[model samples]
Target: MKSCQCYLFRPPSIMSISSWVCLLPLIFYTCLAVGAKPASPQNVNVLSLNTNYTLTWDWDYNSSDALPVSFTTEYIPRFKLSSKRVVVWNMACEESPRRSCDLTPLDLHYLSIFILRVRANVNGSHSDWVQKKFCPDTDAAVGPPSKVDLGPAGGHLDVFISDPLTSANISMREELQELYYHILYWEKSEDTQDLRSRSLNSSVNMVTLPNLKSWTWYCVSIQTRYDFYNKFSSFTNPICMQTQGTLPWWQIVLYFLASLLVFFVLMLLILCGSFWCYRIVKLTLYPPIHLPKHFQEYLQDSPSSDVPRLLTPDSESELLCEVTVCPEPLVLEVHQPPPEDLEEPHPDLEPDIRHSRQDSGGSNDSGIYSTGGSSGLRPCPSLSHEGGRTSCQDIYDPQQVKMKDMTPGIRSQLIIDEGVLDMSV
Candidate 1:
C-alpha cells in the first residue's frame, strides 16, 4: 500500500477576484501558510473518594475553526509522596474533539490524584501538561479524610485532624447532615470493652473494636473527614500484642482427676495405718496369759513321796520346800537363806539350841545341818512319807542359815506376804 505525504506551502499575497476563481481549485488542495497556537484549557479537579472509586471528565470540540483534539487520561499515586507512580489507560477516543471517559476501582493501593489533559493536534505532536493539578485530590466540599493512623488493636479506631468541625460521624454513606469532622478511626479486630465503657458521643474522635481476645494484636485505620464516609489518609505502622492462652476442657478434667486420685490414695493409706496401729495396741494391752508350760502338773501331789528327809528327824518336821519354774527361766536348788540373816541381832539374847520344826498347819517342816562349818551348811526338804526318825539332835539353829548357788540366767523376784506380817490394818 502507498501512503500520502503532507507538505507545507506559502500562498501569494495578491490575487484578483475573478482570476482567483481559476486558482481556487489549487488553493483548495494546497496547504495553509501558518497555523495558530492551541488554546489553554481550564483546569479540571480530581475528586476524592472513600471506598475504591473513580472520576470522569467531560469535554467537547467547541472551537469552530480548529480540528478535534485528542484526549489522554493520566494518573499519579500518592501525590507529593516518595512512593509516587504514574498510571496510563487505553481510552483514547476521537469524537467531537471531546473528552468522554471513565475510570474506576482505582487500585486504591496506588492511585492517589489524577491529572486529565487534552491536546490539539493539527499534526502528530503533543502539548505540555495542559491541565496540571498540584493538589489533585483536594476539594472543600468533596474529598477524602486526612491524617489517618494505624493501630494493632484491630477493633477500635482513632482519628485526628488539625481543626475542629461542627459535627462528626462514622458510616458507609458519603453524604449526610451538616456534620463535619476533625478525625476518624476504624477497628479491624475483636473488641472486649463495652460501648457503654465510653461516654455518649465521645466516640467522635476515638473508636473501639470488637470480637477480639484480651491482649490480642490488631490493625486499625483512621483519618479526618467532611462527610461520614471517605477515604482515610496519613497512616502509621502496625503494632502487636500476645493474647492470653486458653486451656482446653480435657486438660482441666485431667487435673481434677489427678487431684482426686491423690486424695483417695492418701485416705486409703491413713485408714490402713490406723488399723495396723490398732491391732498392735490390742495385742500389747490385753496379752493372752497361759500357765508356765507345765506348772499345773506340779500342783497335784504324787501318789507316793520319794523326797529326802532332814537330819533333825522330828516327827512333825517333814516339810518339803517347793520351788517354781516360770516361762521366765529360773534355777532350782535347796537350803538357801537371805543375806539379811548374816547381820547381828539386837542382843535381846537367849542361848540357842536346836528346836523342833513343825508346820502350824499341822503338815510338815524340814531341818538343816552344818556340812562342815558355819559358812557351808546344808539343808534338805523332807517328805512326810519318808517315815524317818523324829526329834533328831544334829539339827542346826535357824540363825545358822548359809548362802547358796546363783543362776546367771535367772532374775529373782521376791513377793513377800507383807499383809500377812501386819496384825493391824
Candidate 2:
C-alpha cells in the first residue's frame, strides 16, 4: 500500500516588491470569488391561482453597487429526477432584481405537481437554485368568467358567455370540459311576472330563453359553475332586452305605400332627366331649317281680290308708283254708265259675283263693254240714274285668258279659280 502527502510553504517578509504586488491582487480576487458570489434565494414559495402560478423568494443584496442583478427561473413536472424546463422569463422581471415572478402557461392538472427553482446572479456570478413544489389545480384560488352578452332572438333571449383562460393553448382536458351555465330572467315592471330560468351544457356557450311576453322589457343575468374543487364564479353583469310585438295592418300598408311612392318618384325623375338629355343631344346633332326671308313674306300676304296694298302708307309715293307699274301693258276696260231709266236705284249694291266665275258663257244683256274683242270686259257697276231698279246678272268668259303683264301688286291680289283670275287690277 502507498500514500501521498503534501506540505505548505509560507512567504517571507523579505519577498520582492514585484512579487508581493502580483500575489496581493491574486489573493484579493480569490477572496471576492469565494465570498462575494450572490447568495442563493431563500424562502422560495409558490402562490397557485386558477390556471397560473406566482413564484416568490427572498434575497439580501446592496442595490446601490454597480453590480448588475437579475434572476433565472425553471420548472420540472413532478419528481426531482425529471429534466428542468426554463420558464421563458416574463418581460416584467427582466430589467432589475425581482423577488417574485408570475410563471403561467401552466398545465394545471390536479394530479400533476410542478417543482419550481429560482436563482440570483450578480454580473457573471450565479448562485445555487432555490426549489419549491406545489400542485396548481389543487392549490389555486378560483375566479369568475370574464364577460357575458345577451341579445334578443325572435321571442326568446340568446345568452353568450366568455371564460378566462390561463394559457393561450389550452387542450381539451376533462377539468376544462365541465363548465355549466345558469340563466335567470324576469319581466321589468311593478306588476309581478313569473321568473324564468334556463340551464345549458358545458359545450354550449350560447343558450336561448323562451316563453317570454311580447313587447315587454326583460332583465337577465348568468353565472357559471365548475367542479366542486373550485369555487363557483360570480354572476355576470345584468342586461335588459325587449321582444317585438305584432305590427298593425294599417302601419304595414302605410310603410309599403311610402316605399312604393318613393320608388315611383325616383323613376319619374330619371325619365325626365333622360328625356331632357335626349332633346339636348338631338338639337346638337341636327338643327331646324329656316325658310327664306322673301318666301316667308310671300306666305304672309293677305288673300284678297283688290290690288294688293304692298307698301305701307308712310312709304314714299315713288315706291307706290314703282309697285303699280307693269313691264308690259294689257287692255284694261272701264264700264260706261247705263242710261237714266234702266240703272239700279241703290248704286252701292254689288251683284253676287261668285256664280259668274264658274259660268262658261258671257252675257251681253247688261253689257257696257268698251271693246268688241273678248279681251276687254269689266263687271257692271251699280250706277245712280234718273229711274227705277235694274235686274242684276253675271258674265263669264269661256275662252282661257293668259296672264300676260300683271304688276306684282296685281298678281298678289289675283284670286285664281279653275285657272281664271277674279280681279283685273
Candidate 3:
C-alpha cells in the first residue's frame, strides 16, 4: 500500500474591508427582522386543579396604532424536547383573544411531564414562544373537599370530609399519596371572632370536636391539603349544624314508655271502632221479622180454640117451609046419548033410580047427581036438558074432601073430575 500525504486547508485570519461592507447590510436586515417581530408573552404560568389545566401569560400592548394582538397556546411532552427527532406540538388554543387557555382537553397524564408554550400574534406575525414545565401530579393545586358533613355525637361534633376527585373520578389521595384535610369551624353568629381550626393527618378523613356547647349552633368548612406538594385548597362553603346535650338514662326510658303508651291507646281505639262498625254492618244486612199486634195476641190467647173459628166464615140463616095439599073432590058429569044409541033400562037399576028421585023431592034443578042415605051415598039431583041432550054434573063440596098430612119435604095436590084423576107436586 502506498502512503498518501494529507494537507488541512486553513482559513484566512483576517477579512478585507470591502467584504465587511458587503456583509454589514445583511446582518442589519437580519437584526431588523428579529426586532420587528411581535413581543413574546411574559411571566407564562401553568395552573392546574386536579387534572384540569390552564395556561396564562402576561402581555402588554403599549402602542394603540398597532393591530390588536391575540395569543396562541401549545403543549408537547417534555421528554421530546431532548430528542433530535422532530415532534409536533399540540395546539391547545389557537389565536385566542383571551390571555388564558384551557389545556385540560389535551388529557395530559398526571404522572407525565409536559411543556406548555404561549406566544403573541399581531397582524400576521408571531413572537418567540414562552415556555413552562408542568407535572400535574406535583404542580396541580389540591381542590377543596368534595363533600362535608357535620354530625352530633353526645357533647361532641363530628366533621366528615371527602377528598377531591380528578376528572376520572379518582380520589386525589390515591394519586398524591400524602393527602389530608384542613378544617375550620365557628359558631353561627353575626361575629366570626370565635372561629376554630384543626388539621388532620393523611390517614383519617373524620375529625371530632370535643367539649362543644350543647343545644348550640355551629358551622364548619373543609379544605384539602397536600403536605408533600405544599398545596392547600380554598376552604369549602360553610355548613351549619346544631349540637345536642346528652340525655339522662331515666329521661330516655320515660320517653320510650310514653311512645309505647300512645301506640297502645291508638290500637285499642282502632279495635273498638272496628267492632262498632261490624255490629252496624251486621244489623243493616240482617233484620228480624215481627208479627202484627192483633195476630200475635190472637195466637197467644188460644190457638186450638181459634183455629176452627178462623176457618169458618159468617152467613145468613136459612128458612124451611112445609106445604100441605088437600085431595080434590070427585065430580061426576053424565051426557045423554042419542035416541038411536039409547037402550032399555035394566029392571033392577030402575027401582034404585026411582027411589033416589023420590028422596030428592024435586028440589034440585042444577042437574047434579049425588047418592042418597039409602045406600050410604049423597043425594042426587034431577037431570037437565041442554041443546036437546040430557046431562048431569055432580055437585062439588069442599067440606066433603079430606086434607092429608104431608111429609116434611113433600108438596102435592090430588084432583078428580069426570072420573079422571091428576096428582101434582
Candidate 4:
C-alpha cells in the first residue's frame, strides 16, 4: 500500500547560452580523458622454459596519456571455436611496471597448435587484443642441437651433434633422459620417397655414415623422440653435405715426386740450351786467324836481276863501276860499318849457330849452305865472279832469326847499294 505513492525524480533545467559556453570546455576535456585508451603491447614474445612459458611485451609510456596499465593473457586451442574462454590475469604486472608474465603448473600438448591473446587496460579503457598462433612442439620444445659439425673421416661422413639444451626442472630432466634422436637423409637428386633413416639412443650423439658416394650431395634432417610417449617432434630444417673422396698418401707423394722430376728436367734443358747459344755467339763474334801458303813462298823466293837489289850502307859509284865492267852483274858491295856500334843481343838469347855445307856443281858460288835446328844463319848457293867482290845473292829466312825479346825495340839492320848488299857485323 505504501508503494502506491512513489514520486519521479527530475534533473535541473537547462542553463543559459553563456553558462553552457562556460561548461563546454570542462566537459570536452573530461570526455577526452575518459575515452583515451592505453596503446596495445608491442613485440609480444613467448619463451619456452623447462616447465613453463614466459610471455613478454613492451610499450612506450610517452606515446599515450593512459598510465598504469594492467595486462591479461588467454590461451586456447587454435582449431577450437567454443565461446567459453579462460583468462590468466597477472596481479604482479597490474601493480607494477613489469612487462613479463610466467605461466606455470600447466602441461601443454607437445604437438598441439595454440592461440595466445594479450590485452591491456588503462583506467578501465581496454585495448584491442593481440593474438598469435603457434605449436608447442615446434615453437615451445627444448632447444635443438645448437651446433652441428660435419666432416670427412676415413672416407665417411662424420656428424657431430651437441647441445640438447639442458633443463633445471626435474620433470624436464627426466624427459630428456628418455629423449632419442631420429636422423633422416637422402640424395639431393632423388625423390622424397627415396629417403633413408637412422635411430639413435640418447647416449649416442655422434654418427658416422660410411661407404657413401664421394662428391655427392646429401640432405639430412634430425628430430627429437620420446620413447615412452611414442611422440616425435617436428623435423629440423634440412642441411646439405658431401662425402669425402678417396685419396691415398702414396698417391700424393707420387704426384709430388713427378712434379719435381719434371721441373728438374726442364731446368737442365734450359741451362744446356743457354750454353749452346753462348758458344754460337762467341764463334760468330770472334774468328781465328790463319796465314796463306803463298805468303811463305813469297818470303822464301830469292831476288833475281829483274828485282831491285836491297840497298846497303855503301858507295853507289863503286857498285855501278863494278856492275858495268864485270861480265856478270856485281851482286853487292859493302862499306865500313857505321860510326854507331851494334849492341849485343839481349841476355835472354842463346847465340848458338848450326850449319851444313854441300858442294853445288856448275855455279859461280860453289858451296851451298843450309841452316839446321830452330836458330841458325847460313848463306844459300849463289853465282860468284872473278873480282875480289863476290857476286852472290842470298834469300833471307825468318826461321833463322831467334831472339827471346822480339819486341819492337830490337832491330835487324841490312843495307844495300844497287845490287850490292851489306849486313851489320
Best by TM-score: 3
Clash counts for all predictions = 24, 0, 7, 9
On the 0 to 100 scale, the lDDT of residue 384 in model 2 is 36
User: Model 2: per-residue lDDT, tens digit, 175-204?
Assistant: 456666666667776655655544444446
Residues 58-148 of candidate 3: C-alpha lDDT, one tens digit per residue? 8878731457899988889999989999988988999999999988777888899988888888777798989999998788888988888
List, residue by residue over 237-302, the lDDT tens digit for candidate 4: 878787767668998999999999999999999999999999999889977665565554444435
Which ten residues in a row are the worst by lDDT in model 1? 416-425
List ranges where model 3 is wrong by over 4 Å.
1-36, 60-70, 186-191, 194-202, 213-217, 248-425
lDDT by residue (195-217, candidate 1, tens digit) is 22212122254344444555444
Q: How accurate is candidate 2 locally (lDDT)?
A: 0.60
Judging by TM-score, tell me the better candidate of 1 and 4.
4
Off by over 4 Å in 1: 1-30, 37-40, 51-62, 66-69, 76-100, 108-116, 121-128, 134-425
Candidate 1, residue 165: the lDDT equals 23
Which residue pairs clash in candidate 4?
A: 311-415, 311-416, 312-415, 312-416, 312-417, 331-419, 332-420, 333-420, 364-384
Predicted model with the maximum lDDT: 3
Model 3, position 11, has a per-residue lDDT of 43
Q: Which candidate order results from sorting by TM-score in descending order?
A: 3, 2, 4, 1
Q: After superposition, how far is residue 341 of candidate 2 from its true place, in Å?
A: 95
Q: Given candidate 1, what's the lDDT at residue 187?
A: 29
